[model samples]
Target: AEAEAIVRYIKDNPSDNIGVITPFVKQKEYIKKELESNGINNVDCGTVHAFQGDEKDVILFSLALSEHTRPETYAWLKNNRELINVSTSRARQQLYLFTDSNALERLHDPSQEDDLYDLACYVRSAGTYQLTPKPVESRALGIRPYSTATEEAFLENLTHALDNAFSDGSHYTVHKEVPVSQVFMENISSKDYFYRGRFDFVVYRRYQKKEIPVLAVELDGMEHLSDHIVKARDEQKEAICREHGFELIRVDNTYARRYHYIKEILTQYFRS
Candidate 1:
């Protein structure tokens, strides 16, 4: 529906320079494909990051958020004010935001108090200047470790396998949740780097006191198959790792029993 509305808006005002921006790469691709299918390929359509320095007479922004989306999954959207600013300020004359109003409003319902609520309200105001709410003082209850049973098991097994495979002086260190940007220096924009994401585990070898990152690993679960966002993120991570000359080993949770298979791959990588 939002894609059709954007197409209609562009057609209705042919004189206005229009652009379509979406937060998700998948949605951006879908929107572009939809426009192209309808013989409307001239208009610019891309992710918000893709239009950072560009502006148009009119811009259509799609949130691509649904009611089923977990608020915590998109917490980054609220934390990064610059991202929101870029998405909303791309239109010189008019900006149309497509979202689920009910779902957005629910994010602010006293019990939730999510930053997306502020975002939803700001978008609802049609770019009207509004002071952002002051963050409430909060205290951390405790630092509880967060890891799925499968992930924990995989980490334990992989750690043991790596320890056994590598020599004592070689110093094969296994680090978890290593940021991708730290491993590679690229000419890509900051916005793209921001979402490059983290590797579940990174294997580094210290030879003659110089540490070298040799491999990255991702533990995939059922969610990766069912959730398009997770799948897209995984693909992006794999692409970036490959581009930087790092091999990414993706192991499914179902393969947890096949420790030898993972060990063999690691052995081959280390030996080569």
Candidate 2:
């Protein structure tokens, strides 16, 4: 009842940013809609995984102890201590713990303790904190949506350059509308993969009369400079790709935005 009330309050007040911490992932969509309807931008419901290396001025931790007392409770408690620690430490000042009486009673003090007691001791005391509603942190990504025509044109221009680059009688196969496979990484085991990273456009190259596998031509968008995490992850991906004898050509999006430069990178990569 309290959780629902808080969700309703945050939704009605859009000017106030809201953070919801729930033990279960089921509440995300419900909370997201409440915030969106009120025009309160930047609402995030964090699970244990999403809380890493992230912090805010205020934190609403929903520590439902019944959640922690399930079967395999000991393993969940041990492996998840860091997650709880990180989630609790996120608040610089205000901290609101939405929990039931049963959960509150589970905290074992020197004067009182329980099976899942030590976890509650880690929470920091914000000087005289209360249940006052606070604004949420704005960590929203500003992405401009492109129309279908724009995307089609972008891919058309991108492929043209790729075709021009690899004149080794190689065919360029574009997998534009397909989803990237996360399971593809499972095939690789051990050894440092180099030229690692994500590419905007992955062009597969097929060479005639040769047993060489397809090469991947990646298109790098201009936003690469602003999104450092993606860039770093891409670097790691590229390194991994190198282990499998795959060819990777990183064509800058700025270059792809233009036909001549895109063609130049493609021709240079494939022609080599």
Tell me the tens digit of each residue's lDDT in model 2 across 1-272. Answer: 43566566565655644566655565555555665675656766767556544445566666544545543443354325344444544444444666555645543333422212333332333222221121111111102112233345558877676565654675766655322232144446553332232344466555675332355555443223334454565576666566666666665432334577666665665557
Off by over 4 Å in 2: 1-150, 162-169, 177-186, 190-199, 206-213
Q: Which pairs clash (backbone N, Cα, C closer than 3 Å) in model 1?
A: none
- Those runs of model 1 whose alpha carbons end farther than 4 Å from true positions after fitting are 109-116, 126-130, 135-272
What local lDDT score does residue 65 receive in model 2, on the 0 to 100 scale?
47
lDDT of 1 at 246: 79
Candidate 1 per-residue lDDT over residues 195-230, each given as its tens digit: 547888888877887778888887664335433455
User: Number of the top candidate by lDDT?
Assistant: 1
